[model samples]
Target: MVAGEKIETREERIPLWKLKLDPTNVRFSHLPGPLSDKELEDEIWKENETRDLMKSIQAAKGLIEPPFVMEGDGYYIIKEGNRRVVALRKLKEAVDNGEIDDFPASYFDKIPCEIIPKKIDPIRMDIMLAVWHVSGKKEWDALNKASHIFKMHRDKGLTYDIIAEYIGVSKSTIKRALLAYEECQRFLKKYPNDPVGIKRFTYFDEFFKKSYLVQKATVDRSFRDKFMEWLAAGKFRTHRDVRVLPDILEDTDATKELEKGTIEDALNTLYRKYPDRGDPLWETIASAVEVLRSMPRSEVKAILEDQAKRHLFSNLVSEVDTLKAELNRIRNGRSSKLK
Candidate 1:
C-alpha cells in the first residue's frame, strides 16, 4: 500500500487450498490460556463452533464473511480469518472423502476472499489488526497483548505514540504493558526448564501496577522468586488475596505468614491480621468489627436468623449496655466528689 494513497480492496472467490495463514497476524498466532500456538490453532478446527460455521457455509453454498488477504511470497497470505480459512480447508477435505452424507468437494472447492494490494502498508495493517484483536470480539489475553506491544516497540521499532494512537490507548498504558511483559519474559528466562505454562506468567502483570508489593518482591530476590513460585503453583488467587499481599509484605515478619495452611486460614490471617500483631484486644475487636463492617446486610441477616447466634448477639448487646452504665456511674461519682 502507498502512503497517502487510498487502499483499494475487492472481493473474489479463491481456491481453499491456495490461501495460507499470515505469520504476521499478532492475534491469530497467539492463543490464550495454556495452549501453544499450533495446539490452539489445531484445536480451533475441532471446536463445535468451527463445525457449525462449516455447516453454514455448506448451506449458503459460499462463505459470506470473506477472509481478508494480500498477495505475498507467491501465495495469498491470509491477513485475517485464519480460522475460517482452516475450517474451509478442513471442510473441503471432509467433502472430498464424502465424510458427510450431503456435503460435496465441489461445494467446498472455493470461498469468498477480500484481496488487497500486494504491498499493503505494514504499519496500517498492524494497527487494523491490533484494534480488531485487542478491543474487538477476539480479545487476546494479557500475555499476548503485552508481548505484541513489546515486540512492536522493540523488534519492529514502532514508537509508543504510534502504537497507542492506533490501539486507542495512552502511551503510559503501553509502557506499563511492556514493563509487565518484560517481567514475564525475565521469569521465562530463569525457569526455562519448568513445566508450568507461559500463560500463568501474565498473572504477574497486576503486580507491576502494585509498587509496594512488587518493590519488595523485586528488592528481596528470594521473596520475589518464592512469590513467583506461588504464582506458578496457582496458590495466589482472588482479588482479596491480591489486595492483602502488600499489607503482609509491609507489616509481617515473613511472606510465609501470608501463605497460611488452608485458603480459609490464609484469609483469616490476612483479614484478621494474625502474627502481624497490633494491640491484642483491640486487634481482636478490630478484626471482628472489620468482618462485620464488610459483611453484606444479607449475610448479617442470615447469621442473625440462627437462634444460637442471635442469643449470642443479644448477650453482647447486654454487655455493652452494662459497660455504658458502669461508665456513667463513675462519671456521676467523680462529679459529686468535685462539687
Candidate 2:
C-alpha cells in the first residue's frame, strides 16, 4: 500500500503461494533460461540477483522490508520488493524439503506485505515501480528505466508532465529516455542478436543523454542514419569515438578526416585543428594515464595538492598496488616453469 494514500491499507502476513511474481516487472523478461524456465520463473522462481538475496534472508532469518503490493486479478502484484519476495519463496521451498536444518515452517510460512485495495489503477502501479526503480533504492539499469518510461508514455497514454511528476524526473529526461529506447529498438532491428554491438547500449545512453547530440540527429536524418551505421558496422571502435561525432558534425574538415576510416587519425585531426576540443571522460582518463606514464614528478605533485583532484590520484595509487600483485604472480609462475 502507498503509505500516504487514502486508499484502504494494512499489513498482512500472506502465504508465499498467494504472492505471484509480477510478470510486468522489467527485469523479469531478461532472465537467461529456456522458455519453459522463463515462464515458470514468473509463477515459481527468479534467478541471478534473487539467488544472492536468498542467501542473505537465510542468514538473517527473515526479510528486512515487507513487499508493497496491490491485489490484481488473482494474485498480489508486487510493487516494490520483487527480489525479496522471490528470495522468501526460495527460503520457503528449502524449509518444505527440510534441506536446511535451522529453517522451519514457522520462519517461512507467511511473509509480511503492505497491501492496497484491488481497485487501484494499474498505471499508478507503474509510477510506483518508477519511484523505486528510477531514483529510489532499487535502481534499474539505464536502458531498463528508459524503456519503462517510454512504454508508460507511448502505450499507457500518460503525458510527459504527468509521467515526470509521477516519477520525479524532468520532462526533458523523459524525452531522452524515450529517444534512447527508440534508438535501441531501431538498432536491434538491424543487428538482431549481435552481442558485440548490443554491448554498446551504454554508448546509446551517453549519446542520447546529451541534448546537443540528439538535436543534430533530430534535424538531420541522414547524419543520424550514417552515424548509427558506423556503430552497427563497427567502424567506431569505442564509445568515445561515437561520442565525438556531434562535435565533428560542426567541423567539415574533421568530419572528412573521420570518414577516412580511423578514429585515432580523426580524433588527432580534431585535437590538432581545435586544440581545446577534448575527448569525453574515459578518453580524458586514458590520455591522463598516458601523460602520467612519462610526466614529471612536479606535475603529479601539483595535481595531488589540489583537494578536488586528490581522489583520482589516490585511486591510481591503489591500482598500482593491484599491478604489483599481478607482477609478483607472473614472476612466481615463471620461476616455477624454469624449475
Candidate 3:
C-alpha cells in the first residue's frame, strides 16, 4: 500500500510451468547476465534458509501461504515467495527424477497464487516487495536489503527519506546501505563476474561506518584502490578488522605493513610504534588525571577537611609518585642504553 495506489488482485491455481521465476529478484540481482528458470532456481536455492523452507514445505506437504505473482506475457512472474516457489520446484524435481518419492507428483502440478494485474505500476511493485521483505516478516539478508535500497534510490530516483518511510528505517540507515552498495558496485566493476564482492559485502558495510576512513578513501584514490584490493584479497580476516583500518592508515609504517601483510601485522606495527595507544594502564592514568583536573574546588576542600578522605588522597598521591618514579627509571635506562 504505497500511499494512494490501489492494486487489484485475485487468487487462482497456476500451473508450475506457467509460473516464471523472476531473474531480477532482489536475492540474485548481483548475479551477472540473464538467468534461465533452472539457473534462477539454482541461485535461489543457494540463498540462506532456502533449504529450511524446502524442509518445512516437505513436512507440510503444501505451501502455508500462497506466492504473490504478477501476470506477464504468457506467464506469471513470481514477486514474493520466490524461495517458496524454488522450494516447490526443487521438491517436484526430487520426485520427478525418482530420487525420493514419498508424496504424489500431483502435489506440485498447480500452485495457489495471488495474482496481481500485469500493468500495475512498477514503483508499486517495488514498494510491495519492500514491504514484504525489507520491513516485513520474511526479511531479506543485509546485502539483499542493501541492493533493494540502492535500486530505489539510484535507479528509481527516490529520496532517502522517502525510501526510509516506506522501508520503516531511518534516513541514515538508508544512506549507509547506499554507501555500502555503491562500494560493492565499485568492487564488482573492477572484478567482474566475481560474486565475492557481494558475498562479503558486510566487510564493505563495516568499512563505510567510520567517517574518517570513508573521507580518507574519498580523498585518496590510491588508498581507495589499495583498500579495495585488500578487501578482494581477504586481507581483512573479519568485519571487526575493518574497524581498525583508520588506525592502520594513520601510521605510515603500519599502513605499509598492511599493504604487504594482514590486519594483525598492521595492528602490531601500530601498537609497537605507539605503545601508549595500546596500553590499558596509560589510558587509566590519563583518565585519572582528567578527573582530578576537572574535580570541583569545593569537593577538593571537603576531601582536605575530612581525615578519612585526606588519608585516601595521600595514598593516591603516593601511588602516583611511585608510578612516576618507575616511568622515570625506565626512561633513564632507555636513555643510558641509547648513549
TM-score of each: 0.66, 0.67, 0.75
Instruction: For each candidate in the order shown, give its overall lDDT on alpha carbons.
Output: 0.69, 0.74, 0.85
Candidate 1: stretches off by over 4 Å: 1-6, 25-62, 102-104, 214-226, 232-234, 237-244, 250-254, 259-265, 272-339
Worst 10 residues of 2 by lDDT: 29-38
Across 298-330, the per-residue lDDT of candidate 3 in tens digits comes to 989989699999999999989979989999999
TM-score (C-alpha) between model 1 and the true structure: 0.66
188-258, model 1: which lDDT tens digit per residue? 77766545546544556777667787677667868667766666555665424555566665645434545
Candidate 2, residues 1-339, lDDT tens digits: the string is 332354566899887777766666675444444334236455435456778888888888888878888776666777678778877766777788888779656777788899976776767667777888897888998877987887788888989998888678999888878877777677777767656644456667788866777777788877667766767666677776666776776777777876776666677777777665664765776677778799888877877688766877778789979989999999999999999
The global Cα lDDT (0 to 1) of model 3 is 0.85
Query: How well does model 1 score by local distance difference test?
Result: 0.69
| Pairs in clash, predicted candidate 2 | none
Top candidate by TM-score? 3
Which of candidates 1 and 2 reaches a greater TM-score? 2
How should the candidates be ordered by lDDT, best one leading? 3, 2, 1
Error of 1 at 163 (Å): 1.1
Candidate 1: clashing pairs of residues: 1-119, 1-120
